[model samples]
Target: MKKLNIVFMGTPEFAVTILDTLYKSTEVNVVACITAPDKPAGRGQKINQSAVKQYTLEHDIPCLQPTNLKDENFIGNLKAINADLFVVVAFRMLPEVVWSMPPKGTINLHGSLLPQYRGAAPINWAVINGEKETGVTTFFIEKEIDTGMVIEREAIAIGENETAGELHDRLMHLGAKLTLQSVLKISSGEFEAIDQSQLTEEELKPAPKIFKPDCAINFDWDVQQIHNFVRGMSPYPTAWFTMHNTKADNNKTFKVFKTTLHSSKANEVPALIELDGKLILALRTGSLEIHEIQMEGKKRLTAQQFMQGYRPEEWEITL
Candidate 1:
C-alpha cells in the first residue's frame, strides 16, 4: 500500500485545518502547500502571510505562493511535486492546469453541502437566508467551481441565532474531519464519487459572494429577515447603515454586530422608537434592538452605552 502524495491548496484558517490533517497523516505524504501570496494588510500595511502559508512554514512544509496560478514557472514547480491528489479548501477557483495535474483528481472541501450554497461565501449566505441546518461537503474538483461530484457530506444543524463567524468555525473543523475521511477512503480504493446532480432531494440554492451593498441594512424588511441579515454579516463585513444627526452633522456609518428582534403590531411609521427605556429601530412590523454596535472611528459599545454619550435628537437612518 503506497502512501498517497498530496498537494494542498488553501488560504484561510478554515483551509489550514484540512491541510494540517493531511500533513499529520501517516498514510499520505503532504508534499507542498499552495496558497495566496503575502500582501500588505492592517493599518501598518505590513506584509501578512496567509493562514495556510503560516501553518506550512511553522510545520516545515514546502510551500509555493504563486502570484498567478497560470504562471508556467509555478506550474513547472507543481509538476515536480508529482502529487497523487490535490485537496482544496477555502481557496480560489483553480485553473484546469493545476486541478488536472494530479492523477487522482483534485478534492475540494466546501463549507456547505453542495449542489446548494455553491459559491464563495456559502456559510454566510446560509445564515443570511435563515437556514436551520447546513453542513460540509467533500467533492472532486472539475471545471466548474463547487459543481464537482460529491465524495462525501456530513450534515450539521445551524444554531438558531448563530452568526456567520460562529458557523464558519464549526464548519471549518467539520470540513477537516470529512476531508480526512475522504482521503482515507480514497487511499483504500473503496469509494464512489456521487455526482451532485444525482442528489435531487433538495432544491439548489446559490451562495454567491456578498458585496458591500448586500450588507447594507434595509429598515423596510421584516424583523426576522433583518435579524438574519445582521447575524449573517456579524464580525466581518458587518451589516451597517448610515446615520444622519438632526444638527446636519456629517453622516456616520455604524456596523451592527448583535441584535434582538422584538415583534409588535403595526409600528409607528418606521423610525427610531423608545420603548422600555431602550433604543429600538422601528421597522415595518417590529423593532430591531441593537445589542452591540461600532460607529465609524469609535470603539464598540452596547446600544445603552452609545446612547449615554450621544443623542439621536433629529438623527435618522440615512441612505
Candidate 2:
C-alpha cells in the first residue's frame, strides 16, 4: 500500500498534536510543514518558533515558514514537494493558490461541527452559548473560510461546569483522531464530502474573534448566562469586571475563571456578597458563586483565599 504524501500546516499547540499524529502514522508521509514565521514574543521579545515548527525541527521534518503565502518563490518550493494532500489546523487563512496546490486538496480540522460555530473562536463560543454538546469536524478547504465540504465529524458532550480551556484540550485530541480517520478514508477514495448547505437550515451562530472588551463580565444577565460567559473565557483572556472596593478606596479589575450558578436571587443585596466564607456575585435573577478569581496585579485565588484578605461587603461590582 502506497503512503499518502501530506503537507501539514499549523502554528499553535493545538495544531502540534495533530501534526505529531500524522507524522507518526504509517499510512501517511508528512513530507513537509508550513507554519507561521518565527516572530518576537513576550516581555523580553525573544524570537519564538511556532509549536508545529518546533516539533518539525525536533523530528527532522522539512519545515517552511513563509511570510507571504502567495509569494511565487514559496509556491515554487511548495509545489516541488509534490505532496498528495495538505492538512491544516489552527493556522491562518490560506490563499487559494496554496490550498489548491496539493493533488488531493487541502483538508482542515475545525473545532466545531460544521454549519455551526464556523469562525475563529468556535470552542469559546460554544461554551459561552451554554451548549450541551460540541464536536470536531474534518472538511475539505474551499474558497470561503470554514465553509467547506464536510468529510467526517466526532461529537463530544460538554460538561456542565467545563471551562473553555478544558473543552479546547478535549477537542484538540478529538480533532486529531477525526483528522486521521478522514485522511485514511480519503486515501482509500471511500469518503463522502457533503455540502454545508445540505447540513441544516437553522440560523447560524458565528464564533468571531474575541477581544478584551468582549471579555467584560455583565452582571445584568441571569446567573446561568453569567456563569457560561465566565467559563467560556476562563484561563485565557479571562472574563473580568470592574469592582469598587470601599475599604481599599479604589476600583480594581477582577478576573473570574470559575463559578457555580444558583437560581435563587440575592434579594436586596449588593452584587458582591459573601456567605459562609464564599464569594458570590448577585445578579438580577440569580447568583454565581465565584470559585476562582484574580485581582488586578495579584495571582489567581480560590473563593476562600480571596475572602481572607478583603471584605465582600466593601466591594460592589461597578456597573
Candidate 3:
C-alpha cells in the first residue's frame, strides 16, 4: 500500500490538531501546509504566527502563508508540491486552482454534520440555537462552500451547559480522528461519497458567521435562550453588557465569562436585576452568577474581586 501525499491547509488551533494527527500517520505524507498570513495581535500589536504555522514550523514542515489565495506565485508553489490529496480544516475559502490541484481531490473537515450548519462558525451557532447534538463531517470540496459530497460523519451529544469553547475542544480532537480515518479510506479507494443534497432538507439549519452584534446578550428572551447565547459565545468575543455601579459613582462595562441560571417567578420581567448584591444579577428566569468578568480598561477578575472595588448603587448594568 502506497502512502498518499497530502497537502493540509488550516489557520486556527482547532485546525492544528488535525495537522498534528496527519504528521504522525504512517500512511499519509503531508507534503506541505498552507495558512493565512501573519497578522498583528495582542496589546503590543506584534505580528503573530497562526496556530497552523506554529505547528508546521515545529514539525519542520514547509508552510505557505499567502495574502491572496489566487496569487500566481503562491499557486505555482502549491502546484510544485504535486500532492496526491488536499485536506483543509478551519481554513479560508480556496480558489478552484488550489482545491483542484490534488489527484485524489481536496476534502474538508467541517465542525458540523453537513447539509445543516453549512457555513462558518457552526459550533457557536449550534450552541446558540440550543441544539442537543452536533458532530463533525469530512467531505470532498466542491464549488459551493461546504456543499460537497460527504465522506464520513460522527455525531456527538451536546451537554446542556456546554459552552462553545468546550464544544470546540471536543470537536477538534474528534475531527482529527475522523480526518485520519477518511484519508486512510481514500488512499485505499474504499470510501464512498454521499451527495450532501440528498440529505433531508427539512432538518437544515444555517450556521452563518457571527458578528459583534450577535454576541450581545438579549435579556428580553427566555432564560433558556439567554443561557444558550452566553454559552455559545463563551471565552471569545464574550457576551457583554454595560454595567453601572451607582455606589462607585461611575458607569462601567463588563464582559461576562462564566454564569449560571437560577429559577425565577413567572411574572418577573426579563433583564430586570432583582438583586444586585456583589456582582450577581438576578434575571426573570434566573440570576446570572458572574464568576469571571473583565471591566473596561482593567484586567479580568473574579466576581468577589470585582465587587471589592465596585459599589452596587454607583454601578448599574444598562440592558
What Cα-based lDDT does every candidate model obtain?
Answer: 0.86, 0.91, 0.85
Better of 1 and 2 by TM-score: 2
The model with the greatest TM-score is: 2
Candidate 1 lDDT, 36-150, residue by residue in tens: 9999999999999999999988999999999899999999999999999999887888999999998899999988888889998898899889999889999999998888889
Supply candidate 1's per-residue lDDT for 66: 92
* Ten-residue stretch with the least lDDT total in model 2: 261-270
Candidate 2 lDDT, 172-195, residue by residue in tens: 999999999999999999999999
Residue 158, model 2, lDDT:
98
Position 55, candidate 3: lDDT: 92
Among the numbered candidates, top lDDT falls to: 2
Runs in model 3 deviating more than 4 A are 43-45, 248-250, 264-279
Error of 3 at 131 (Å): 0.5
> Could you tell which candidate, 1 or 3, scores higher by lDDT?
1
Per-prediction TM-score to the true structure, in the order listed: 0.93, 0.97, 0.92
lDDT of 1: 0.86
Residue 218 shift from truth in candidate 1, angstroms: 1.7
